[model samples]
Target: MKILIVGPSWVGDMVMSQSLYKRLLELHPNVLIDVLAPAWCKPILERMPEVNQAIEMPLGHGQFSLSQRWMLGKSLRDNHYDHAYILPNSAKSALIPLFAKVPKRTGWKGEMRYGLLNDLRPNRKIFQFMVERYVALAHSKSTMLSEVTIDDIPNPALNVDNENQLACLQRFNISPDLPIVGLCPGAEFGPAKRWPEQHYAYIAKQLITEGHQVCLFGGPKDKSVTEKIVKALSEHQKSMCFDLAGETSLVDAVDLLAACHTVFSNDSGLMHVAAAVNANIVAIYGSSSPMYTPPLSQKVRVVDTDINCRPCFKRECPLGHLKCLNELMPAKVLDAYRDLNRNQNLE
Candidate 1:
């Protein structure tokens, strides 16, 4: 069977969707899986062993012009796919699959896609995590969603090779023998999700004092924040910190992160990557609730204070205090790191 998966656009969502792709492969090992995703996420999809090829979807804004959609649909029709799984909820997300005239189109019953999806599934409330929701779609209506577990999902792996990891580290002058700690301080969501810069600096300093080198990771937009974090650290701590924010590509960031002993990050793409790599991860959640989208790895340790107004799901704190994140002291984070390190040493 040939399957075409309509992938989610967001980086983290794309990673989470891998769970569904994995389950499909497990059920039908002989099946060939192809993904339709944005150009930027091609590297991530290409890395997955289950994915045979990633078709780049050219999109501008939420809507793809009728002409563009027709062209894309034509291209997909030529592939002669047997089935298409639409991951995104938008009505437009189903256009290509419908136009391609795939034998079977599957997705949730939303966006009023009456004629688009031939096998529409009811959006059940049994699955708590978004990843689980994505995976449950693969099963028949009689399948029990409650029985789905993390074991059913495919673990995250980088498409980049080991040689690339070593080469990237060498190019960055990072020594292999020295223990590395990764810090991801940016959240594309908004300021509400961000922990204070001072707290990040404090954690960096603590890690350095404990003899670990720190690497700051984020996009070019976060360069200013990274510089401030480095400046806040004491001279001794600063010496051990490397500001590679905006310097490394997403593929390169994953490779470098794979080399780290642990990663401390807000709920972001890198955090998901760290979990996929099975790195010891300290995931800090703010406006976002852990219950809905916690890291999908056993090695992850999530920290979230039970603030009454938390998990508002807002981009910015409705109350301005941002206490859910700000109240989570640096000491607590440091303590978690120490505990993780001790546990790893015992193993």
Candidate 2:
């Protein structure tokens, strides 16, 4: 079986899509799965054992570029893909599969993609987790996603690059000598999802005081936020914390995260990556609900409040106070982290 997957754009979504690829391989052991995603996704896709190849998608998200899409799609015809699984819902996402003339193109019924996808699934809400939704498409259209239990689905596990891990530790002057605790305090979604910088600093100080080296991780947009967290720390605490935000590539972060003893994170891409790397995780949820996209790690403690206005799923706090995060203190996440470590020790 030769399959082509039009992968999702976001880091978390891309990580979760591995479940679908794993399912495809399980159903057809000899399947050759090639993912078509943005060039940014190449590093991630390369780490998935199920993916045979990672084909770079030249166009950016929300870009129509009809001529470019046609050209790119036409270029893949020679691969003779038997099936194409489009992970993104955008109508533009399906154009390549259509142009490639794959025998079967599968995806959820989304935007004006009626004719674009021949094997379209509906009622996407039936599946709760994003991973489940992606994995469900691997089954026949008649399959009931609701009937699929969480344990039945495969959790994404990214293969750690040990060589790159050593390189990153050396390049960043990170000491693997002491236990490392990583902090992912940035959320691309917006301020509503971000936990207070002081809260993160508190957690970092606590961890460092416990003799753990702390490393902060995020994209370029999050550099300033990470800086604020570091500034909040005392000079001694600052010496123990490595502000790695905007410093490493996505793949480098993945490699380094795998080396951490634990990770304290907001509901962000690195949180998902940490889960995939099997890091002990303190997944702090704010405006976003864990019910939708919980970290898929057995060694995770999901911390969230029962604030009524929460799970608003807004980019910014519509209520303005941002109580969902501000009210949920760092002590709670600290307790969760301790509990996670306790469980790990027991195991």
Candidate 3:
């Protein structure tokens, strides 16, 4: 079987999409799967062993360039894929596969995509995990199987290269002498999801004082926030903190994160990337809930509070005060980190 998967745009969603690819592989061991996603996600899809190839989606998200879609579709005619799974709910995301003339197009009922998807699956009961919803579309509409009903669903496991990890470390002038604690302090979604920077500096100080090396992680956009975290620290603490927010590429970040003993992150894309690489992780949640998109790793400790206004699911907090994250405090995450360390040692 030859399948073309229209992957989700976000880093976390694309990582979780591996469950669907793995499911397809299990059903057809000799199947060939190719993912069409944003160019930024190419590095991630490259690490999933089940994928046969990665096709870069030339157009940006929400872009409806009919001529470009038609041109790209025309280019793929010879491959003759058997199936196409549209991971995104937008009507625009379905256009390529339709233009490609794939026989079976599968997706959830979304955005009035009436005839766009021939094999449509309705999300009647809201799925608990985003992975669950993505995995369900791997089956036909009639079979109706999903991760919710399945046993032993595989979590995303990104393949790591030791050589690359070594190179990344050397490029950054980093040493493995001390235990590494990676701090991912930026949330691309919005500030509502971001824990206070003062809280992060406190964690960084505590870790550095304990003789652990702390590295801050984020994309180019997060460099300022990461800088704030580093600047607030003591000179010695700042020396221990490696600010690589804008310095490294996503693939480089993945390799560097693989060398870490533990990671502390807000509910963000790098959090999921950290999880996929099997980093010992403590994922902090503020506006988001773990039930929907928890980091897919066994070694993770999710730190969230039972605040009434939490899990708002908005890009930014509607209420001016983000008490959900502010009141959760640094001590709670520190306690979770300590427990995770104890468990890892016992193991």
Candidate 4:
């Protein structure tokens, strides 16, 4: 069997969608799976062993150029894909599969995509976790959705590039002599999802004091956020802290993250990437809830405040106060890290 998957746009969602690819390979051992995703996702898709190829999407996210979609889809006809799994819920996302004339096209129901998707799953929310929803599509439409458990959805495990990992460590002058603590304090969603910079700086300082080196990680948009955290740290702490937020590429960041002893992050892309790499993770949740999208890693600690208005899932806080994140003190995160460390030692 041959398959074509229209992958998710966001880094985290793209990473999580690996579960679906993995499930497909298990069901059909010899199946060839190719993913159609944004150029940004190429670095991530390359890490997945199940993917046969990573085809770049010409049209940008939210771009609805009918001519472009038709041409791109027409171009794929020669590949003779037997099936296509559209991960995004939008009607536009399903166009390529239809235009390509794939025998079967599957996806969750959303936004006037009735004719676009042939094997539509009506209730995506039935599967609580995003990974569950993706993996469920791999099963036949005749199968009951409720029968699929969390265990059925495989955790995404990205293959580390050891050569690139070494090059990044040398380029950044990061030594493995001290235990490395990676801090991912950026959330692409918005301010509501982000933990305070001061809190992150406090954590970095405390970890450094305990003889661990800290590496700040994020995309270019998050450079300011990481800079603020660095600014709050003392010169001595600054020397011990390496702010590589905007410095490293996504692929390079993944390599470096795999080398960390532990990773502390907000509910963001890097958090999911850290989990995929099998790093010890301290995931801090604010506007988002872990119940919906927890880290898939076994070695993970989820830190969140029990606030009434939290999990609002808003870009910015609807209310003036951001108690969900603000009230979540740095000490609480450190405590969670300690607890996770203890559990690992016990095991």
Candidate 5:
């Protein structure tokens, strides 16, 4: 069997999509799987052993260039894909599969994509986790997963490149002699999801005091906030801290994260990446809920607010108080951090 998947845009979502690809391979050992995703996500897909190819999408997000989609779809027709799984909910996401005239196109009822998908699922709420939803698409629409819970599904695990990791450390002039603590303080979503810079700086300083080297990780967009956190630290802490939020490529960040002893982050893509890399993680949740998309790691401590008005899931806090993340308290995160370290030591 051959399968083609239209992948999600965000880093976390792309990482989670591995579960579906894994399931497909498990069910059909000889099946060839290809993912149609953004160019930036190709490196991530390349890491997954189940994926045969990672085809880059030419058009930008929210771009409705019909000619481009049609041309790409035409280019793929000779591959003769047996099935296509559309991961995104947008109508445009299904266009490529339909244009390719794949035998079966599967997806949830998204927007006005009535004719776009042939194997339509009436609802997505049936599955709790996004991983489950993606994995479900691998099966027949009338069928259900043999293992009902998410625990039965495989978690995303990216293989490390040791040489590249060493090269990355050298490029950043960072020595791994001290225990590493990775802090991912940026969320591409918005400020509502980011913990305060001061809070992160506090954690970084405390970790450094305990003799741990701190590294701030994120995309280029996170450079400013990471700088803010580093700036708030004392000179000694700054010396021990490496701000590589915008410096390293996503591929480099993967290997770098695998080298960390522990990581702290607001609910973001890197948080999931850290979890996948087997980092002892302290995941902070502000406007987002952990129940839906908690880090897929056994050693994670998920911290969230108990306030009723929280988890509004908005990009920015509408009420403007921003108490959800602000009131979450840096001390609480420190406690989790310490507890994780203790547990790991015990093991």
Candidate 6:
């Protein structure tokens, strides 16, 4: 069967969506699976073995223009897909599949998409992990939702080659001998999601004291935040940390991250990428609850407080203290790091 999956635009959601693609491929190995995704997340879909093609969705956020929808619809119709699975909840997300007139359009019944999706799945009774929610769409009406464990999902294998890694290292003038620990300090959601910059500096300093090199990673918007993190580290510690935020492309960032022994990140895209590469990850959660969207890998260790106000799911914290993230001390994170290292050495 030829299938088209309308993937989520966010990095973490894209990573979680991989499980669904894998389950589909396992059930039907010969099926041609194409993904419609944002340009930023195309690299992620390209790395998944189940995805045959990654079609870039050009329509920007907010209300889609009628012309763009018609154009997209016509383009999808030409592909002749038997099935299209809409992953996002937005009403516009279902338009292309409906426009293409795919035989089977499946998704949860949100945004009142009665006409858009032919096979609407009820989510009221199914309270499970986000990965399971995505994968369940692949099941037939007769098929029962099997209990899925972390083992059922495969790790994200980045498509980057060794030459790409070497080139990126050379471009940055990064020494091959140094042991790198990648630090991703920015969370796009809000300030409530970000751990204190001084805390990161403290952790980086500690890592350097232990003779490990540190590399900061983030997008262009996070350049100032990354600078603050580096500046806060002690002068001796500063030499050990390289501020690569806003400097590297997504592809280059993946390559550089793949080279790290471990990655410390806020609950962001880099955290998911680090997990894809099977790097030992320390994922910090703040305002957002980990229950709904924890890193989907055993290689990751999540640190979060049991604060009542936490998991508010808001862009910014309603309370000024921001204790959900603020309470999680750097000492706790360093402890997790030590434990991860010990386990790795034994393995």
> Which stretches of model 1 miss by more than 4 angstroms?
144-147, 150-152
lDDT of 5 by residue, 244-306 (tens): 988888899999999898999888988888888889999999998887788887898888789
Instruction: Assess the local accuracy of residue 116 in candidate 6 as a C-alpha lDDT between 0 and 100.
Output: 84
Candidate order by decreasing TM-score: 4, 2, 5, 3, 1, 6
- lDDT pick, better of 1 and 6: 1
lDDT of 5 at 316: 98
**Alpha-carbon runs more than 4 Å astray in model 3:** 145-151
Where model 2 places Cα greater than 4 Å from the true spot, the runs are none
Clashing pairs in 4: none
Q: Which candidate model has the greater lDDT, 3 or 4?
A: 4
Scored against the true structure, residue 134 in model 3 reaches a CA lDDT of 84
Local accuracy by lDDT, each model: 0.84, 0.91, 0.88, 0.92, 0.90, 0.83
Instruction: Find the 10 residues in a row with the least total lDDT in model 4.
Output: 144-153
List runs of model 6 lying over 4 Å from the truth.
141-144, 147-151
Q: Which residue ranges in model 5 land beyond 4 Å of their true spot?
A: none
Q: Assess the local accuracy of residue 293 in candidate 4 as a C-alpha lDDT between 0 and 100.
A: 85
Span of ten consecutive residues with least summed lDDT in model 2? 141-150
Model 6 CA lDDT for position 102: 84
Instruction: Kindly list the per-residue Cα lDDT of model 1 for residues 95-199, writing each as its tens digit.
Output: 898888898998888888878998887764567778877887787757746557656666655555789899988888887899999999999889888888889
Better of 1 and 3 by lDDT: 3
- CA-only RMSD, every prediction: 1.5, 1.0, 1.3, 0.9, 1.1, 1.6
By lDDT, highest first, what's the ranking?
4, 2, 5, 3, 1, 6
lDDT of 5 at 107: 94
